[model samples]
Target chain A: MLWTVMPLEAVLDGSDSYEPEYFDVPWNDGGRLIVEKLNMDSARVVRLISGNANDYLDASIQPGTIIQYAPKNQASKQ
Target chain B: MTLSPRQRRSSSARRVRTTPHPALQEQPKTHTQEKEKGQDVLQNIQQLGQTNIPQQLSENGIHTITIIGQIEGHITLPPQNKTTKYEHIIPQLVAIEQNPKIQGLLVILNTVGGDVEAGLAIAEMIDTLTKPSVTLVLGGGHSIGVPIAVSSDYSFITETATMTIHPIRLTGLVIGVPQTYEYLDKMQDRVIKFVTSHSRITKEKFRQVMFCTNQLARDIGTVMVGKDAVDDGLIDEVGGLGQAIAKLQSLIKARESKGGSTDALDSDAP
Candidate 1:
């Protein structure tokens, strides 16, 4: 229910600029990803908000749905 | 009364310089200037009077911190029991790194060594911090002190400094389960990995030292004196404060040559 902005260069560098596991692939509400405790499944979004993740995301997609990408640098404030 | 002209001639011949060695003749005049500067600095240290560090030792922004007690994790004893916290020291270390006056850091240790986790944590933090650091072992750097010795860019141990490397030991009741034992083993692995990676000693050599059976009466470990520690590659040199400071200066100069600033070394105000 929250969103943060980040730069694309940060994720490419593989640095942990964001809090670990905070960002993830925002799947649609009807979709479900497998959750296994033993698999050590932890999402690591490198806080790439500007280009890569952001451009691929659609914030106004749907209320009950989640976008699977970060917000673009241009529409960040929106 | 006897005419000993031959003996006199021989003595005079010995004193006569036969065209000084070519190497000495080729020496640059600047070399002499450098030598004189070094001598002046030595005299300055002597003039500091007691600690004999000339009042100007801090001239070039070189500051020194002397840790005269054991630096380990929290324990019950008294004021000395104060465990150097990560939060407390992290800021100091960061400040030192960011300060423009501090050219380098000198950590003088006289600890009996405590808290493997805390000790390794500090050592690793120093190992990675982008600053020239030098550690001097004064009295004893035992147990987890092994990592601290190698954490700096270089290290010095006094002739009397003693370092003990022993297997990890815990003094308390523990959960007697397979999972608990597994967790403990993993934690130890983390420590050993950090130590071996940042130091010259290899995993096998470290294993031998950590498991030596005859060193401690109550535990299996190895005790290395100053020179031995250096020979074993635990400490870089067997020297005193001057050598340590000199090494720090050299490193600072190297860093400066690489376009980094050396002013942070002035003082971080604790």
Candidate 2:
């Protein structure tokens, strides 16, 4: 049951046909980031699955952040 | 007069030659790093359509969390709608509870409310927090937002702010069974129990307001403006942000003093 001021139709519009594609990437301090794939190279962060309280404080990894998918070799070089 | 294509190209080439190539100029390492940072910021802006992420205020002991738009639940809302995801908020609350430097919390609400279970979860967390907290309701705090507004140690509503009290309803597909109705009623009771326990409003008064007729157009509910909410014992006061902060600070001070006395007693116990 939903308790909201918004109309039911407006809230559930497009939900039936839309299926989000999310990937779980290992993040800093053993945390995992749930990101929705936008394209091949990048994904938008949806949530951070972490037990560490400090992990939630990082601004760069907050929800809505676009994370670039760098290959292991390229990431290590940087 | 516009220059011919040949003349424009020749002029641009000459200008480029006169102004040494940017990369050829000797630059400090910091300058290059700053440029890269700027590019990253630009890319983030382009991708997220937002200029900057919200930074926690470090200058004060009080942390403010604004609950606006829809309170999202298990299903993510479409991108166009503004939503306060419970996942983001729950972690922040955990961080706030663990952080010793933070003395109080101020929740600012301007929400239409959303998923019932998510809203109740947030409210329960706020109510159980050991630190001093105050909620200031601006604009409108409707539906599930009422429970959240009352969850804090003290709640304030702006003079123009309003709260809509209405019965919870099921959305989407429903089986034509009596059990479904019973389940929905039980879910609603959880919200009513939380709100009535935390605030001064009685369960009877709240239910009366919730089932009130003739107050809302085409809806069975009552809309309580700031002062009316206070008068009805639904909210503590009708004030703005400043008052809410002042109240929180005072509450924090009281807690500190009480803690100090308890410490003194512990020392004397030995």
Candidate 3:
């Protein structure tokens, strides 16, 4: 995931900002995908394979979806 | 094994007419008092730990809509029940999120909790809703209600509210060996994972409470008093809606003031 520090003014339209959800496709182009964990600025873009976003949106994926990586807690360690 | 739950201690008929408490007890024959009385109950929940109730929102130049019901699953649970109706509430939450005048949501919960998938779905909607959401546990918000309790921007529970944090269960099932136990273990992990992720509890403490052997008569979990819940960091606050709303306002203002999101980044979609 890409981690970048951008101001809130960049990504948010004040009225049009959408919280991270399963509908959004990862726009990662291999190098390193930016994970804007706290960027309220502009919408941080993640590179995805072509048509990934559309397919992800059309697919009935549940919200609050996650990609668990490193062990942040004990249960995850296993 | 599609087994029914142990016969409910309550009567079957009593379960059928599960009407909203206010609507059942007092119907506002007078148009003036109807809205006023509803507002009063909302205020009481809001000011639970306090002495006085606030005046009507109309007088204060605010408009509000309070959705008070149990969100069980697909099945229409007994009225007064709190099953997360994913289909019904998912859209309602979406609507509420989009409503501009609806400044905040005061979600008062009195639920036994139901369907993990459904329960978490409701909690997720509440969590993601653009409008501020505040959840208060009145009598009990147990089982899956735990997640809904914490889903709010801020949370509160009555001094008497009780919460049961048991491991997940799929009511009657066919299993004879350790494999069944293994499946249960894995299912419980998912519940714990969600609970800990949404609340202040760490995975270790959440597991301890979920599997706390010393607490229940026939279960593998701990029941928490409102105060105990806050002390253990399972819930955010221990007062009723008053504290809950105050906390929610603070959170909303905090977010509104500085547009910072505390979203954790993950990839595998739920």
Q: In terms of lDDT, which candidate is strongest?
A: 2
The segments of candidate 1 whose C-alpha lies over 4 angstroms from its true place after superposition are A1-78, B1-58, B72-87, B262-270
Instruction: Tell me how each candidate scores on DockQ against the true complex.
Output: 0.01, 0.24, 0.01
Computed on C-alpha atoms, the DockQ of candidate 1 is: 0.01
Per-residue lDDT tens digits of candidate 2, residues B1-270? 222322111000001122312222221122136565565567566544444333444666788887888898876675555677888788888887767667789999999989888999899899888888999999999999999999999999999999999999876688989999999889879988988998889999999999999898868989999999999998999999899999998998898788733233456675
Superposed by TM-score, candidate 2 places the C-alpha of residue B222 at a distance from the truth, in angstroms, of 1.2
* Top model number, DockQ: 2
Error of 3 at B220 (Å): 2.9
Tell me the native contact fraction for each prediction.
Answer: 0.00, 0.40, 0.00
Q: Return the lDDT, model 3, position B9.
A: 10
Give residue B104's error in model 3 in angstroms. Answer: 2.2
Query: Model 1 over residues B1-270: C-alpha lDDT tens digits?
Result: 121222111000112232422222221122136564454344323321113221233476564544333342443122212123332344455555655655678877766565566677678777876878999998777766677778889999999889877666433467788987787667667767876776677788878887888777856778889998888777889999899988998998898787665433333335
Evaluated on CA atoms against the true complex, candidate 3 attains a DockQ of 0.01
**Candidate 1: residue B220 lDDT (0-100):** 75
Interface RMSD values for the candidates, listed in order? 35.2, 16.7, 24.6
